[model samples]
Target: MSALQALRTVSGKLQKTQIQVSTGLRVATASDNAAYWSIATTMRSDRRAISAANDALGVGAAKVDTAYAAMSSVVEVLSDFKAKLVAAREKGIDLDKIQNELDQLKSQVLSISQSASFNGQNWLNTDVEDIYDPDNNKSSVVGGFTRNADGTVVVNSIDYSMLQSALFNSTGGGMLQADPRDLKTIGGLRFDYGNGLMSTYSLRNTGGWGPTDFNFDFSSPITFGAGDSISFDVTADQDNPADGITPPYDAGQTTSIVIDAARVNSALGRTDGTIGTYKEYAAVLRSALVGSGLTATTYTRFEPPGQTQTWVDVPDVVGIVHNGLASKDGSSMAISNVSFNGVTQANQIAPRAVAYGTRNSEMTLDFEPFTVYADVVVSMRLRVDGSYSNLSFDKDFADLALGKDNGKVETSAEMATLLTALVNRPDVIAQASGSGTVSLKTDPLVDRKSGEKSMIGIDGISVNIEPVPTMNFLDVDVARNPEMIDGYINYIETAMGRVVSGAAALGSLQSRIELQSNFAKHAMDMIDKGVGRLVDADMEEASARLNALQTQQQLALQGLQIANSQPQPLLSLFQ
Candidate 1:
């Protein structure tokens, strides 16, 4: 072998060994720095993680900003609603036209309310809703809110599928009862007794309300002899026996009388000079006496020996005046005294009587809130989503009726209710419909003709007055208003104002969040750059270092060679 070849081989081996030790790696080529390469590769991975997290946070901020912006639009819409409601109170204004404008504005408000969204996550569009109140640490429906049964976290989450199933009554088994109640009816006339109505008898001339009346007739026939008088029962006749302001003038004199049974067969046709329907009965007795010739003269008035409030003897004269006429019985009519022209028909006057029911002093009827279910989804989270036609209600306005003009909250809750019913109502509302207005009701006006209206909501949430469901605007009811309509009217306006205010607040919050998100993104970028400077190797700098390491290694090789030569000289001396 050539000496040069041996030297070249040994030098190659040393160079290879130096490369491993200098680089501190098994492989010297770029691929040989496995550990260093591994570190760089891991650093790149960590950088990516930071970048990803930054981008995700940025997106979250953007979502929050979008939600806030939507709320701003909502505020404007709410303002419009308030203004319109307030205008409705103008005395001489065209209420119908004003209401039309109000309806349009309300629709816009609802659009804003429901259309709010943020990064597909809706802040206002809560589903299993909840409200936090530090005061009570609890929420109540009295304020017109719906929340989870346990009331922990706000159920402000809604799934796409849940929103999708909204073309009809998809809640529980509501579809089974979806048909309108207008289809129900009752035939013929009906009577209603307020609190009390007399039956068969009413004291205050209630007989005028006729079913019928009970009556009896009496007949009397009699003739008077010299110094004689008589009285009798005219049970089968047509004569008012007793009905008088002043007595002693005619047979139909007294309105009340007692029968003089002893005088039933009186021979004469007179008594103290007062005649009654019994006069006819007296005529009968006199006729009999005359026919028998036993003294048509048997008609006689006699005075017992010493009677003071005395009966006077009848005179031959045809007319006379006296007293002690008749008396009355507690209940039944008893026939007695009479002054007869002859036997003719006479009727007996009977008192009118009736039974009464117990009276009721006061009564209160409660009208409650209603629920509405439809398949109209609103996109109020972001402007991009707010324009959607898929609007719906959160099951709070089901069966509101006419005359139930109850008030509502000024928050998104009001918006939700109005949107669900007014936005897509099949009749007076718009949109594709569900078991909404047609299936449910929240109107407060009755079709005076149809006379059919929802009495109340299934939830028992009452209305102050029923909305008059119409092709245009609904009628307003201000029943027994303590505020005399003004306060109520103001309340409506205030509600609208509240809605606007809330929207504005939400918008402000969104703006802040968006700004902060952008700032955060920029800050994160700067931080990552700084981190990279901290521990990651620079490719160019590393390459330069490698060159320096190579030079040092060559010098070390020369030093070793010199040291070996010195050892060889020592060996020569020994020789």
Candidate 2:
């Protein structure tokens, strides 16, 4: 080779070796090797992305751990609360003290939720933003890093919706929170008797309106003389019947007729010459008054010579014999009293006889005013205090045949039914549609875990934590009714179940985050190693190459020197 070409070749080889030895790299720039340099740069970028994803995963794991811890604390608090409730259920336990402990445990749960935060992120304490879709509360952490075929960077993440769970949701019903409850019942008749005593009487034995198959009992028969008479009067208020105030037989307008002694002994005969047969006399008197016609009002009586005596408007009666000498008492009864509507008669009437009378002889005389009729019958007047009490049937009695028909008592059965209805009316203060008796109130909670309009009375029991206008356990005097402690135990157990479910959800989410974090760490390490393989310089290999390149540079320089010396020899030849 020519000296100039040999020197130029050696100089180029020495420059290349010096550059390789100083730089300690196979491909330093794209100009050195386009394909390898581009691939190494891209892989290094991917490794950095993996590191960032791992950092995000760590942060997410911390948040999940914090939530998990808070949930665990809540579960413990609920457990303690349940224990207190169970203790309260024990016979003769201090319920107030147990309730205090339960309250404290609930406070602890709230405290834990508020304090459970890591790196300025509190999952348990805060509520999810998306209320409509609870699952939209995505608290995911990046788990993987990758490059798409289209040159887009793809990051894979692990999903965690722990905060959206029912336990931690504050806007909804959380584990630590509770709603106010009111009393509700099914199937019962509610009556406010005010301040009166409630009493029931069996009235099936009593007659409807007439002298129902009733007879007189003679303790002993009496022998009457020619100049003795027994008299009694029954008066009815045509202006006012039942005192228009109370119930039962309140809305009735009735008439009263009196049976005098002259009509009983003279008109209706005693059968025996000495008036021994009293029952037959009483029957004859009752029959005569039922068909007889007389005035309904009171007036004076006048008599004309050899003519019949006339009463203008005397208390409607049948017989009109007004002679005291012809009247006689057949039965030897001294006193006879009347009673109606749980009240006794004001006065008693005694029988009179001129002859010797046995003390035990008794007879029943039916009065016309208290007797029965085919169409219109006289009703018993109810008295309150000294005066007669009345009721306005149009305003008081409702949905009854007697009230609708305007007190025209027809049959005995109809009258009995009306009585029953009136007696039961006091028990029904209000009406609703349910089994037995049910009282309903408004919704306790508007929105909660499941949905809106959560009712207070779910089961037969009501849980009350606040003072409301209704009855509740808080207002219950446990000392008076010791059986109420058992109910609180059941409530606490139900609350514990809710807290446990929340804790379980938290644990599951925590596991997911931890697993994703572990995978992210492992994958990031692998990616770093791969990037190192693609671009990282091997120190031992580079050192060996550096020594060899240094020797090669020295040899190339010697060769260039040899080539320049040859040019010097050629100059001697030219001399």
Best by lDDT: 2
Provide the clashing-pair count of each candidate structure.
Answer: 91, 21
Worst 10 residues of 1 by lDDT: 181-190
The reply for model 1, stretches above 4 Å from the true place, is 1-50, 129-485, 496-501, 504-534, 537-545, 552-575
lDDT of 2 at 516: 68
Q: Which digits, one per residue and each the tens of the lDDT, describe model 2 over residues 316-374? A: 22222211111121111111222222212222223221111121111111111111111
CA lDDT, candidate 1, residue 333: 19
lDDT of each: 0.33, 0.42
Q: Model 2 segments beyond 4 Å from truth?
A: 1-24, 129-132, 163-170, 178-487, 532-549, 566-575
TM, every model: 0.31, 0.44
